[model samples]
Target: MNLTQQISEDMKTAMRAADTKRRDAIRLLQAAIKQREVDERIQLDDAAVVGVIEKMLKQRRDSIVQFEAAHRHDLADAEKYEVSVLQAYMPQALSDAEIEEAVSEAISIAGAKGQQDMGRVMAQLKSSLSGRADMGKVSSLVKTKLIG
Candidate 1:
């Protein structure tokens, strides 16, 4: 089944299980996917769905960071819960070792010489690493490999 169909079934399961937090998160996700489709007038494949989920998770992570910095643990905890819910839909995350290997490969392929070539290296790695690894972490990895 497609991601949309799987999400529909998961929503129903969440509802039946009375998991309000998960159910609400899933609803918000579905709404975002629908909005993107309507805005672009295109059908989203699994990769697109993963992209949407990743965007939401990034937002939640930012929120959590800001809230914690502001000494608002309550709000940060809420964002963390949503983060966990969203992560369930994503593929297994890449390990640090795996991310490093990919970064090295991208740098070599792009013939990146130094930090100036970050854009080239990142462009090459984006699609291959998306949803599997965090770009912020990947960027640091690329920078480390390129600078030395």
Candidate 2:
């Protein structure tokens, strides 16, 4: 089944199991997916679905940080729970070693000589690394490799 179908099935499972948190988290995800589809007028493939999940994860992480800074542990915990639920549908995360290797390869392929070519290297890395790696981490690694 596609990612969308899998999410639907999980939502049903969550409802049947009386998992309100899980169900709500998934409903939020589904709503986001549907919104994007409606906005773009295109069906999102698995890769696109993964992109949505990644976006939600980023948002939740930011919210958690802000909530903690304001001493709102309860709100932070809720965001953390959503993050965990969203992460379940993501592709397996790349190891540091693998990410390093991919970054190196992208640099070579893009003919990136220094910081000036950062965009080229990132463009090369983005497609292959998007769902499997954190782009923020990959970008920092690229910058370090280029500068050093």
The best candidate by lDDT is 2
TM-score of each: 0.92, 0.98
Give the TM-score comparing model 1 with the true structure, all chains together: 0.92
For model 1, residues 1-148, the per-residue Cα lDDT tens digits are 8889999999999999999988998999999999999999999999999999999999999999999999999999988998988898898888988988888888889988989999999999999999999898898888778777
**lDDT tens string, model 2, 74-133?**
999999999999999999999999999999999998888999999999999999999899
> Which residues of candidate 1, in runs, are more than 4 Å off?
none
After the best TM-score superposition of candidate 1, give how far the Cα of residue 90 lies from its true spot, in angstroms: 0.5
- Highest TM-score, which number? 2
